[model samples]
Target chain A: MERPARTESPTIGELGESRTLARILPRLASGDAALLGAGDDAAVVAAADGRYVVTTDLLVHGPDFRLAWSTPFELGWKAAATNLTDVAAMGARPTALVVAIAAPPTTPAAVLEGIADGLHEGLAALAPGAGVVGGDLSASTVLTIAVTAFGDLEGRAPVLRSGARVGDVLAHAGARGDAARGLALLFAEGTDAAGEPDPERAAEVRARHPELVAAQLAPHPPVAAGVAAARAGATSMLDVSDGLARDARRIAEASGVGLDFDGEALGADLRVAFAGAEDHGLLATFPPGVEPPAPFEVVGRIVPAPGEVLIDGRGIDAEGWDPYSGWDGRSG
Target chain B: MERPARTESPTIGELGESRTLARILPRLASGDAALLGAGDDAAVVAAADGRYVVTTDLLVHGPDFRLAWSTPFELGWKAAATNLTDVAAMGARPTALVVAIAAPPTTPAAVLEGIADGLHEGLAALAPGAGVVGGDLSASTVLTIAVTAFGDLEGRAPVLRSGARVGDVLAHAGARGDAARGLALLFAEGTDAAGEPDPERAAEVRARHPELVAAQLAPHPPVAAGVAAARAGATSMLDVSDGLARDARRIAEASGVGLDFDGEALGADLRVAFAGAEDHGLLATFPPGVEPPAPFEVVGRIVPAPGEVLIDGRGIDAEGWDPYSGWDGRSG
Candidate 1:
C-alpha cells in the first residue's frame, strides 16, 4: 500500500475511512477514566461516584467558527474545553469525552489528526486525567464537531443553578468575558475588508492579542474549581458561559433569588463584561460564614429580589450569545 | 411574547434559541435513570455498577441519510437506535443519551421537534428506560445529529468483541440485510429521473414496501438481546452496524479467531446479507453448551482460522458501508 510522505497531506477519500481512522486514532490518548477505549463495540468509563454528569455541545463551520480564523487544533480544543466546562459546572470532574466530527471528503486527514491532538492537549491542560474514549467520523460539507462529556462528582452532590440562597456570597473563578471580547476583536480586526475571516489578518490579530484570541479559541477553564467549590460548601453553581450577568440571571431565575455584582470585580469594561459570552468560568454562591475556594473572588451577593441580575443595584438584561438568532446567515 | 399557532411552522431563526428550545424540550422526555435532567448545566445519570458504557455516532444529511427518503423523526430515531445498540452490545442497559444537532437557520423548528419525538419514541421502543436527558442545538450548513449514549453494566463484566473463543456457537439477533435492500429499493424506485431523491416517489415506495423501508429508515435493533447474550455466557458480542462479514471480521481480528456463518440463516440473499449495513443487530458467540438468549437465532460457529470471516468455508471480504469513502458528495 502506497502512502503520502509525512510532509504531504491526503484527503480522507484518498486514504479511505479505515486508513483515515488509522492515521487519526493515535493522536487521541485515552484517559484513566476509560476502562475500555475506542475500537470496541463501545467504550467503558469509570463513574465511581455512582452518578455521572453528562452534557453535549456542537460546533459547526459557519455558525460556531470560521476555518480561516481557527486552526483545526483550536477547533478541537475549544470543543473539548466547552464541554468540560459544562461538566465542571455540575461540580464534577470530567472523566471522559466522546466526540464526533464531520467534514468534507476533500479535507486533509491530517486536519482531523490535528483536532485529535487539540482534544488531547486541551484535556491535559484543563482536566489532566480526562481523555477521549470514543468518537465517530463522517463526511459532510460543513466541518462539525460534537462533543459529549462525562464527569464524576466524587459522591458529592451536584451543584445546581437553583441552589442559591438570599444571603450567600457570589464568587467567580475564571475569565469574565475574555472569549467574547476576543471574538469581537476578531470580527473587528481579524477579517478581511470584505468582512470575511482572513487567515493572514486573523493570525496577525492573534499575535497582537494572544490572550483574548486564545481565550476565544483554546480556553483553559478552571476545571478543578467546580469540585473545590462543591467541597467548600457551594450552595449553587453554574458555568459562566453566556456572560457573567446573563448566566448569573439563570441562577437567579432558577433559585428564585436575585444577584448583584460589583462592576469593578468583573475584570473588564462594564459593558463588555455585562454583554460578553463564552467565558467558561465558575459562578458560585457560598454561605455567609463559609469562604469560597481559591480563585473564586467575591464578586457579588445574592439578593431577595427574585429573577433580577443587577450591577451595582441596576438591573440588566440577560444578553447571552445565541447562535440561532440569525447572525451571518451563512450556510457554507 | 406573540407566537405562531401550533399548526403553523416557523424557522429556527424566527423562533430564536430560547423559544425553539421551549418547543423542543417538551418532546424529549427524560427517563428514570436521570437523577437530574435537562435545564441544568448537565444531566446526572445513574451508573449503579460504578461503570458506564459510552459511545457516539454522527449522522449527516448526505452520506448517512436523505431527507427525501427519511423523515426528521426517522433520522432522530435511527441516530438514537444506533447509539443504543452500541451500549447494548457492551451488555449494558442504556440509561441516557446526550444529543447534539446542527442545522441551517432556515430549518423549520418542527423538524427538530419531530427529531426529539423520534428520539423519545425510539428509546421507548428499543431501550425503554433510556431517554434524552441533555442536548445541544447549533446552526450549520448541513443537518447533523450526534448522539452519545450512556449505559449501566449492573455489575456484569462488559461483553467485548475480543472475547470470542474457538468452538463458540455464533448467533445473531435482529434484521440481516433488510436495511440495505430497502435502501436499494429507495434509490431505484424512489428517485427522480436524474437520480436525485424525490419525496413523493420515496413516500410511494415506502408505502408499498413499508417493512423494508422501515428497516432502512427506522430500524428496530434487538437491543435487549445484547445483555441476554452476555448473561447467557456469550464469549463475545458486537452490534452489526456494518455488514455481517465486515463486522464479524472485527471480532475475528480482535479475538484472533475466525467466524463461519450459515447462509440460509441470514434471512436474505447471501450477497446482500454479507454486504449489508445498518441492520443494528447483535452478533454474538456463546460457549459450546450455552444457548443464546431469546430472539437470538443460531447463525454459525467460531473457527480457529485466524482473521478469516467465512460463509460456509468460503472467505468473504468485509464490505461494510463507509461514509468517508465518498458515496455521494452531497453537501446539503
Candidate 2:
C-alpha cells in the first residue's frame, strides 16, 4: 500500500535531551495532585477518594514502525500518544506517563534527542506538560519503545468499551484516515508498472505531504475530545489506533451488541482521509438523545445484532492489520 | 556470573499456573473503580479526582536474570513485581498491570503460561486479585519482559523521593540484601572448582536461607507498607530497586540533604542477607517527632548536605550496578 505524501524530520542532542527534560519539567510542573513531578522512582498522582486508571502499550521498531518511513521524533510522539489516549478513553484525565526505550548502542544520540523532543512536544499538547513523569533508556538490537499512562476519573462514572447500549449514537473525534492516505501515497509513488510498490515511493511520500506522513508516523490522539465525550455523556469510548471498522467491532464485541454504520455519512470523509491505518482518533458512543461536542462527527449507530461488522450494509473482506497474522499487503 | 544449583528443574507450566491467574482475577472484579478490569484494550480504573499514577520497567533475561538458577515462575513474578513496586513506592495503591514478553519461538507456551502464573502470584499478594489487563507476546533472541503498573492515590498526598529533610528519620520495610546474597550463592555455585556449581553448598543455602534465594528469583515488594508509610505522613519514599545506599542517594540529591546511615543497625542485617543485587524494598523517611510504623526498622537519619551519602559517621562508597557499565566484581 502507498503512504500519503509527507514527512516530519527533526533532531536534537542526546546528552542534552535528558538534561533538558530535567530542566523543563519543573517549569512545566503544577497542580497540587502531582506531588512528585519527575526525576523520581515513580510519580505520585493524586487520586482523592481512592482508585486510579492505568494502561500500557509497546511499540517495536520492526513490528510497530520503521525508521526508514518515520522519524525518531514521530516515533516518540506516537508511542506516548497511543498509551496516553488509552488512559483518556477510560474517561480518566491523564496524570502521568512513563516511557522506556531500548535502541542499538550505535544509534545516534541525536536520534534519541529527537525522540525525547517528540515526547516532550506530545506531552505539551495532550497533557499540558504535566503528564510525562518518568522514563528509562537502554541499548538493544532494535528500537523498542514502551509507555504507560495513568489517569484520574474525578469521581465520575468511567465510560467503558463494554457499556455501549442499543440505540447509542456512534461518533468520532480527530482526523479519521490521514495516516492511511499517507501510506497509500507512499505505495503509489513507489509502485512498479504492475502497480506494485518500488523504492522511490518512500522518498516521494517523504517529500510530498510531511504533515499527513507525520500523521502516519506520529498520531496526535484526540485527548481533549475524549474528556469532552465523557462530559457529553458518552457511554463507551476508544481510540482508533486500528482502522474504523475493525476498532468499532471491538466496541461491539465488548458491549455485546452490533454496530451499524451509516457508510454514507463516513464514505466521503474516510475516503478523503485515506483511512487505512495510523490515525488515532477517539471513537465514542453516546446515548441516542445527546449530541457529541463540537469536534465529533456522527459516523455510526449501536444496535443489538448477530455480532459482526458491516461495510456499506454488507460484510467486507478486510478489517485491519494483525501483528501476529501473515501480511500480504491486503489489510493494513 | 554463574547461577545457583537446582535439584528439581521445573518447566514453565508444570503446575496449574495459567488457570490459576484466570480463576483468581474474576473474584477481585467487584470493585467499582475497575469498571473494565482485565480483557480489554486497557483496564479502566476510575480515579476519584481524574488523576492516576503510572510506571514501567523492562528486564532482559541475560542482562537482568538467568534461568539456570531461578525458576520460570520466579522470573514471571519478579518481572511483574518490580513494576508494581515502582507504582506502589509512590504511595499509590496499584490497580492494574500490563506485561509484554519476547522469547524464542521454540520456547514452550507452557513456560509462557508459567510466567503468567508467576505474575499473577506476585500481583495476588499485593493487589488482592487485580488482573493482568493487556500484553504482547513475540519471538526474540532472548526473553525480554516489559511490565507496567498503574495505581490509585485516593486523593492523599503522594510521598516522593524529594521530600526528605535534615531532621527526618530514615526507615525501611521488607527484606534487604537477600537478592544480593542469592546472587552471590549462584555465582559461587556456578564458579565452583569445576565449571559447575557445588551441589551440596547450593542445597545448604536453599535449606537454611530459602527467603534470600527467593528474593533474588522473585522479589516480594512491600506494597502495603508503602501505602502505610503514606498514611503515616512519610516525608520521602522510594522502592529499593537498586541498592539501599544508591537509591537513598537519589533521595538525598533530590531533597538537597545529606543522608547518614547507622552502620550498626545495618551491619547485622546486611551480613545475614546481603547478596549484592535485586533487593526490592521500600526505604522511607519521616519527620523527627513521628513514631516509626510497625514492620519498619529505623536504619538512618537525614542530614544537611548537597547530595551526599554516608555510612556510620563517614562517607562510604556509592557505587551500584549500572546496566551499561561493565561488571568487574570489585568492591566499592
Candidate 3:
C-alpha cells in the first residue's frame, strides 16, 4: 500500500524532539488500556488483574534490520509484534506498548509518522484495543527501536514452560517455516544496497513471494490462540521465536519430559519446521483427554525418560537462530 | 571503586545469548513486586493500584556514552536510574524494570555480568526493593541498553505537569547542573581512548570532584521525595531531566502560569541551574499555605500569565540539552 504524500515535512532535527513527538503522538490511537497516554513523564496503563505481564525487545539497524529491506512502518509493526508475542506466550492479553527510539538527527519526521501509523495498524490487526501509551526519543549514531509491551492476564494463571507432563500433547498455533524461507529467498537474491538490482525486478520478487516476504517482515502471530489454549487447560506454553526444535527442547528440559514429534503432523519440510526462527507461533501442551484449541495443531506428544526432543523417532539437530552465530533471522 | 579481576572469562560469542542470559539472570535480585521473574517469556509485576505507570529509555554506545569512560556496571546503573526517575516524576514507586541489551558478539561476558550487578546496585540504592524482572538480548554492531520501568501509584492520583495553579510554590529535590559540570570536566580532560592520561592524574581529578563525576555517571535522584510531594498535596510534578529553565517552562506552558525564581533560592550558578541536563531531580509545585514537602527546597513561585519562566526578575533562555544540538548529556 502506498502511503500518502508528506511533501516538505521538516526533518526531526529541525523540529526538535518535543515538537516531533507532538506531531507523532496525535497519530497514535490510544484505546481503553491507556488510563493516561503520552505527554506525561510516564503513561498509566490499566492493569485489570492487579498484575502486569511485561516483556521488552530491541532492534538495532545493522544487526536486526536493513532500511533497504524494510520500511519504517514494517519496523514499527515488527517491534510491536515481537514483544507482544511474549505476552501472548504467557496467556495474557496485550494492553499497551512503550517504545524508545534512538536515531540519527537527520532522520525525517515522516519516518516517525510512518512508525506510529504502523504501530496502530499492528495493534488493530493483531491484538485489538492494544495501543502505544508512552515512549522516549533520543539521538544516536545508528537507528534503534526498543519496545516494551504490557499485558493483562484477567486472573488466568500464566501458562509456564515447566508445566508439561508425560502424555501431554504438544501443539502449535500459526505458521512454522515461512519466515526462514523468506529469509532464505532474500539471501538467495542479493541483499546488498549498493548492488544493481532494478526496481522492477525487486518489485517482481516481492509480488511473486508476498507471503514469504510478509512472514519475514511483518509476521501475524495468532495472539488470541494463547488465551484460547489457556482456557482449554494448556499445561505449558511458549512462543516459537528460536525454531521449533530448539524451543521444544526448552519445554522438554524445563518440564523434564521427552517430546516425540509426528513427522506427518508437521505438514512441512523437516528442515524448515525444525530450524525456522521468528515464527512467533505459540507452542503449547495440553493434558490427556483434553482437545487442542482451534487453530492449534497437535504436532507431538510428551513422553517419559531422556527429556529430549525427537521427530519420527529420530533425533534432530536443534540448531536455530543464535545471536552469536550471525545467521540471518528476525531479532525483533 | 575497583572491580574484581575477571581474567580468562569467555566472550559473549563463546557463550551465546541463552547461556549469557543464564549467567546474568542469577545475579539480578527480584523483589516482592515481581510476581514472576526472569526465565519466563514475560514477567508478571504486581500493580497495587490496578494501574501501571510505564516509561522507557535507550542508551546507545557512541552518542549516549563511551565504554572507555563508563564501565558496564555504571552503564547499567545509569540506565536503570534514568528510567526510574520518570516513574518517580509520576509520583509512583518503581516496581520492576525490564532491560533489553544489544551488543556485538565480540563483547565480553563479564561486561554483561557487570551490567547485571549495576542494575541490582542501582535499584537497591535508588529505589530499594525494585528489581529486574525480565529482558531480551540481541546482537548489534553498537552496544545499546534499553530499559522499561513500571511503577505503582499506590492509589494516589498521578501528579501531572498541567496541574500548577497561581500562587503555587515550586520546589525541587536533588542537585542541579552537577551532571553537566561532570561532562564538561570529561571533555576538558580529554575523552580519547588512545590518549592516555596518567592514572594518578585521573584519580586525582575524580577524588577532588567526586560529586560531579558521580552525578554524571550515576545520579542518585531523591526518588522518595516524589511520593512525598504527592502525599503533601503537590499540584504539579516532573523530573528535571532537561535544564531547570527549560523544564520549568514546560510546566509553565502546560499549566498556563508564569514562574518567577528567586536567584538566591536556587543556590547554584544561573547558567548551570538553567541549562544543565540529566540531574534527574524532582521538581514540584504546591499550593499556598502548604509547606513544601521535606527535602524539597522552595526554588520559585507560580504567578499570573506570560506563561514563561523568569529568574530574579529577569527572563532566562530556556536553554537545555537538545540531542540535535550535539551537546553531551545522558541520552539514556
Candidate 4:
C-alpha cells in the first residue's frame, strides 16, 4: 500500500514543544504496579514491601537554564537538587540517581567536568554515595539534562500530596525565600549603573546564605526532614518547586481542602524566601491534633473549605513563572 | 575570578562513546550514594529492601527513526519497545516509564493522542495503568525521545551480561532478523532494476511484509522471556538490540569469555520470519547443567576461549548499521 502524504508536518518550534510527544505516546503498553508513570511532577515507581517513591525532572539549558547566569557546576547541582527533593517530598530516603545529558558537539570538556563536579557536590551534601548512575551523551545545539533519582522508604507508607485532610496543621522545615533573594540580587546587579556582571557579588550571595543563591543555582533540599515528617505522621507532603504559594495550592486541590497561611508564623527574614523560586523546601501537613516534629515551623493550616488559598485572610493569586509567558517587566 | 571564554568544546558523539569516564569524575563532598552509576548499560539503583531494575534509550528522528517510513503511533511504539526491552534484559518485570520529548509547537493534539495510544498499547501488553508520569516538552529541530523504564526485581538477583561463564548454554527467545529483512526490502526497492530509485518495488515490499515493516517501525520485545530467564537462573541476560552477532560480542567482552554459535540451532525456519533485521529477540545464558526452559531455543554455548565472536565457526565482523560506517554488507 502506498503511504499517505505527510501533510501534518509541523514547524521546528512546534515540532520541538508539542508534535513529538503526540507522535510517540500511542506505542506504550500498560506496565505492572506503576501507580503513576509519566505526565506529572515525577514518576511514581512502586516498590514492594510498603515503600513507593519517585524520581524525576528534566532541564534544558537554553530553555531551563542559562550560562549567562549559571555555571556548569551550578546547573549540575540544581539538576540533582530538584530530583532529590521529589523523592524527599514522598518522605523517602534518597539513595541513588541517574543522569543523562545531551549537549552540543562543541561543549567543552571542562564544562562537562564542571557539571559532574556540581552533581557530586550537590548530591553529596544530601545523600552520601548516592552518585550518578547511567547517563547518555548525545549531540545537540543546546544542553539537556534528564535525571532520575531513587530512594528508600524505610518501611513507611509514602506521604502523598493527596493525603492531606481538613484540619491538618501545615508545617515547613526549611528556609523559603533565600533562592529568591539571590535572584533579586542577581537582577539588581544586572541592572546596576555599571551594567557589568560581577562574579564576586554572585559568589558572596552564594557564600553568606549558601542556602540562598545556592538555592537558586543548586538547592539543597531538606531530605532528612521529609523522612522525619512521614515518620511523624504527616498526612500530606510536597517539595516546593514552583513556589510556596503555588505548590501549597496543589496540595490544597489534591486533598480537596483549603489552606490558610499565617503570616505571623514565618519570621520576617524567612518571608523573603517566597520572593524567589528555587526547589524543594518542605511543606508538610499533620493532623490538627498533633504537634509538628522537631525543628519544623508552623507556616499554615489546612481547612475544610475546598479550592481556596488564603494568606493573612486575603486571597492571593497562585501565579508563578511560566516559561512560555513573556516577561514584560524585564525588557530594556 | 573572571571566567574564561569557552573556545574549546567536545563533539557530542565523541563524548558519548569515550572510554575515559574516570577522567570525567568530579570532586565530591559527602552524602551522595550513587554507587555504580554512569558508565554502565544500566545503573544499579539501591532500594532499601527489594531490588529495582532499569533501562534507558534515546531516539532521534532522522537518525534512529524516520517520519517518512513510520506513522506517529509506530514511532511511539518503537521508542517504547527499545527501552522496555532494556528492562527485560535485566530479567525483571517492567513497572513504569518516563518519557521526555522535544518537538515544535504546531503539532496537532491528535498526533500526541496517537502517540499516547501507542505508549498505552505497549504498556498494556505488559502491565496496565503504567503510563508516563512526568515529562517536559520543549522545542528542538528534530523529534527526539528520551525514555526511561523501571522494573521490579521480584526478589531475584539481576542477571548481568558479565555473568556468562565458560560452559554456559546460550539461548534465545522471540523473533530475529525481521527488521533487517524489512530494511533490505526497502533498500532493494530504492535501488531497482536499473540501479535507480525503485519506489514501486518499495511499495510492493511494504505490502508483502507488513509485519516485517512494522517490526522495523516498532518492534515487539520479549519482555517476559527476560524474567523467565532470570527465574530459571540464566547466568547472563541481554536483549538483542544492535544485531545478534554484535550484541553477542558485547556479552563476550563483558564476561571475558568466548561464544560459539551453531547456525543450525538458531532455528531452521529463522529465515521464514524475515531474512535481515529488526527482530528484537532475547538472548540469555544459563549454567551448562541447567535445562533449557520451555520456549527457549538453545542456539549456542559459552566457551572457555576469551575474546572474539564466531558465527558458524568463522570470525566475521559484527558491526551493525551505523550511518557513519556507510552501508556494510548486511544492510543490503
Best by DockQ: 1
What is the C-alpha DockQ of each candidate? 0.82, 0.28, 0.67, 0.06
lDDT of each: 0.86, 0.67, 0.83, 0.62
DockQ of 4: 0.06
What does candidate 4's lDDT look like per residue over A1-332, in tens digits?
A: 11222444432232331223333233222134333333221133444553435455567654466565678778877887887777777777776665666554345444555676677777777766465545554444446777777776777766777788887898887757777776777657633366444556656655665555656776667877887898889998887766777777778787898888888787585346454466468889999778888667888888876767777766666655443231211212
Answer with 2 or 3, whichever has the higher lDDT.
3
Over 4 Å off in model 4, which ranges? A1-50, A181-213, A266-276, A289-291, A323-332, B1-49, B126-142, B181-209, B264-279, B289-291, B320-332
lDDT of 3 by residue, B134-200 (tens): 8988887678899999889999999999999999998888878898888667656634354433344
Candidate 1 structure quality by residue, lDDT tens digits, A188-211: 998878788888999999999999
Tens digit per residue, CA lDDT, model 3, A1-332: 42532767787888888788888899787777999998879999899889989988888876677665667888878888888888999999998898889877888888888777778788888899998888888887678899999888999999999999999998999888998887666655634454432334445557889898788878899998988888899999999998988998888888998888999998655578689888889999999989998899898899884568888777665667787765332332
TM-score of each: 0.96, 0.78, 0.95, 0.73
Kindly list the per-residue Cα lDDT of model 4 for residues B1-332, writing each as its tens digit. Answer: 11221335332222221211222222111112222233211122334335555555556554455554565677667777767777777777676666666543334434444455566567666444344443444444445667777766677766777789988998888777878777666666635665543546655767888887767776777777877888999998777756777677778887988877877886554433323444667778999789767667898888876666765666556555332222211211
In the range B35-113, model 2's lDDT, one tens digit per residue, is 6566555565555544566677777655566665556677878877887777778888887677776654445555665
Chain B, candidate 3: TM? 0.93
Q: Please compute and give the TM-score of the first chain of candidate 3 against the native first chain.
A: 0.93
Lowest-scoring 10 consecutive residues by lDDT in candidate 2 chain A? A323-332
User: Lowest-lDDT window of 10 residues in candidate 1 chain B?
Assistant: B1-10
Clashes of each: 0, 39, 0, 75
CAPRI docking class of candidate 2: acceptable
Query: Cα miss at B17, model 1 (Å)?
Result: 1.2
Best-fitting candidate, scored by lDDT: 1
Worst 10 residues of 2 chain B by lDDT: B323-332
